[model samples]
Every structure is written in structure tokens, then in C-alpha cells.
Target: MTRKIIAMAATVICVLGGFTASASSVAQDNPTVKEVKLRAEFYQNELDLLLDKARRGNFADFYQDVVKFAHYGEKYPQYLLGVMLLKGDGVQQDIGQGLVWIRLALEQKNTEWQKVYDSITAKLTKEQLDALEPMYETYKARFGVQAQKMSCNNEKMEASNIRIHQCRKTLVLKEFYSVYEYN
Candidate 1:
């Protein structure tokens, strides 16, 4: 049972995008880590699966999740948000918004997505690009992100190890970029 639980937790962590330095160095508490781990599980099974559903040609569902995921600060969703908005896939065509989303995606990681960025840029005029500045600032402000501890309440963390828990959250004081949360 213990081995099984450890394996399950490890799998969930993989699905949650794995451990981060911030998650490890932030806090040293079992309860907090447990909750955050639950949040990660939720993120993987729910949000990640939603993206898969969208890929199967569910635009309406895809668009809905995209709106919520826009605030989640992950690369793939941000990229998708950009592409869909740019091409008017389901949401209204908004080149400026597309640029913002794609750019935000780029900021998340250095990936092989330059082509997408290039394709979008190729079509924009200098004037349009210039005009995008104001809106871009607004988008950037909203989309700006930093590493944050995934959170859950005490009840949620009952399964976590104290050592594991300590390495799972930020210990120092922080004004986090985003917290994985559901209402």
C-alpha cells in the first residue's frame, strides 16, 4: 500500500508538470504540500484532459477551457489561445489578442513555436503592431506570471510526507503570480 501510494503520487506529479525549484524551496510543511499536490492532480486530470478534448475538434468546449486556462499560465494553452484568437477559430478574430497570447506562451518557455509567432508577425503592419502596444500592455499585465505554490487546505494534504511536503511549497514570503485554485 505504501509503495502503491508513492507511485501514484509520483505519477500525479509527472502529470502536474513535475517538481519545480519554487515548489521545493518555498515551504516546509506537510499540510500545504498535500493540498498543492491535490491541486496538481486536479490540474492534470481536468485542465489537461480538457485540452485533449479540444484537440479532438471540440471548438466550443475548447474555447471555454481556453478562457479559463488563459489565466493558468501554461505554455500550450496560451499558444492555443493565441492561434484560435488569431484565426477566429471559435472566439472572435483578434490579432492583437492573438499576439498577446502567443507572446505570453513564448515567455513561458523557449520552445519550437517560433514559426507560429513568425506567421502572425508576417501579417501585421507597422501601424497595427504599434497600435498593439497599448493592448499588449494590458494583456501583459493580466497574463504576467511567476512560479507559485499549488494550494489546498489541510484536509487535502493528509497523504503527503513531511519531507515531501516541505519541498513542495514556497517558504519565503511571496506575492505569487498565480495559484492553482478552483471555486
Candidate 2:
């Protein structure tokens, strides 16, 4: 279970795109190490919550919650919504709109999100790209992090001795981490 959690945490950090330090830069006393540690703690809190809820098994409710959180400017949810839109899973199929959500989600770039963005964009024709450009620009202006004035804060969890970081665009709320989450 601990190994599973660490692997999941590593993936979350990669997608979160919060670290740029190379392996050589990580050390026992380095700031990068501290940052990574804090991020792990934050993601672990998310994982614990999400894993528990997922065990209850109501995907429709889960999908709705993801949509809500995406609109709320949480990065991971935005990425999930993008994939959901593209796949027409629990929502209408709309590749163009899906790509838009994904582009917005990549505010903090990582190879994982970049690969998804590139794969989708590569499949688009000139006309499709042209058509989607305006919509993407509009969504970027409206829902982008700068537009939302979204900012993250590290708050101590009342139930535990650790702190969790949450980003708020407008209203603040609690939010998740786990491999089972992706599954």
C-alpha cells in the first residue's frame, strides 16, 4: 500500500508540474527536497479522501464532482474534465471543447499534459485548428488561472498533523490523491 501511494504521489507531482529540480539538485537539506516533501503531503491528503469516496461506487456523482471542481480551478480536475470531454464519458462528445479545457489545465506545464496536448493537436487539420482557435482563446481569457485569480494555500488538516494545499479561484473548499483515482 505504501509503495502504491508513493507511485501515485510521484505521478500526481509530475502532472502538477510543480517541480523542475533535477535529481542532482535534490539533497537532504535542499529547498527542492522540502518542496517535494510538502507537495507529497498535500497530495496524500487528496488521495486519502478520493480513495475513500471511490470505494463507495457512484461514478455519476464522481463525474459531477470533477466537473464542479474543474470549474473551481483545481488543475487535476481540469485535466480529468478534458479527457472526459474527449472520450464522451458521462458527457457529450466534443473534442474541440475538451482540448480547450486541457490547454487551460496546462497552466503549469509537465511532460504528461504536454504529451496529451500534442497528441490531440497533431490529429487536427488546419480548418479544425482554425475553428478551435477562437474558442480556446475565449476560454483561456475567461477561465485561465490569472483570469480566475486562483491561488493555492497550505492549510493544516484538522484531522491530522499534516498540511494540505488547496487552490481557490473564487470560493474555497476541500479537495484529493490515488492510483485508484485514475482507474
The local distance difference test score of each candidate is: 0.51, 0.54
After superposition, candidate 2 runs with Cα above 4 Å error: 1-59, 151-183
Q: Give the TM-score of candidate 2.
A: 0.52
lDDT of 1 by residue, 59-89 (tens): 6667877766665555567777766765566
lDDT of 2 by residue, 1-183 (tens): 223323443444345433222222112321221101123355546644654554563434577766645554567677767766665566765555667778878875545776777765665556656766666665555456654556666767798978655554432233321111100
* Residue 177 in candidate 2, Cα distance off native in Å: 20
What TM-score against the true fold does each predicted structure earn? 0.56, 0.52
How does residue 4 of candidate 1 score in lDDT? 39
Report the Cα lDDT for candidate 2: 0.54
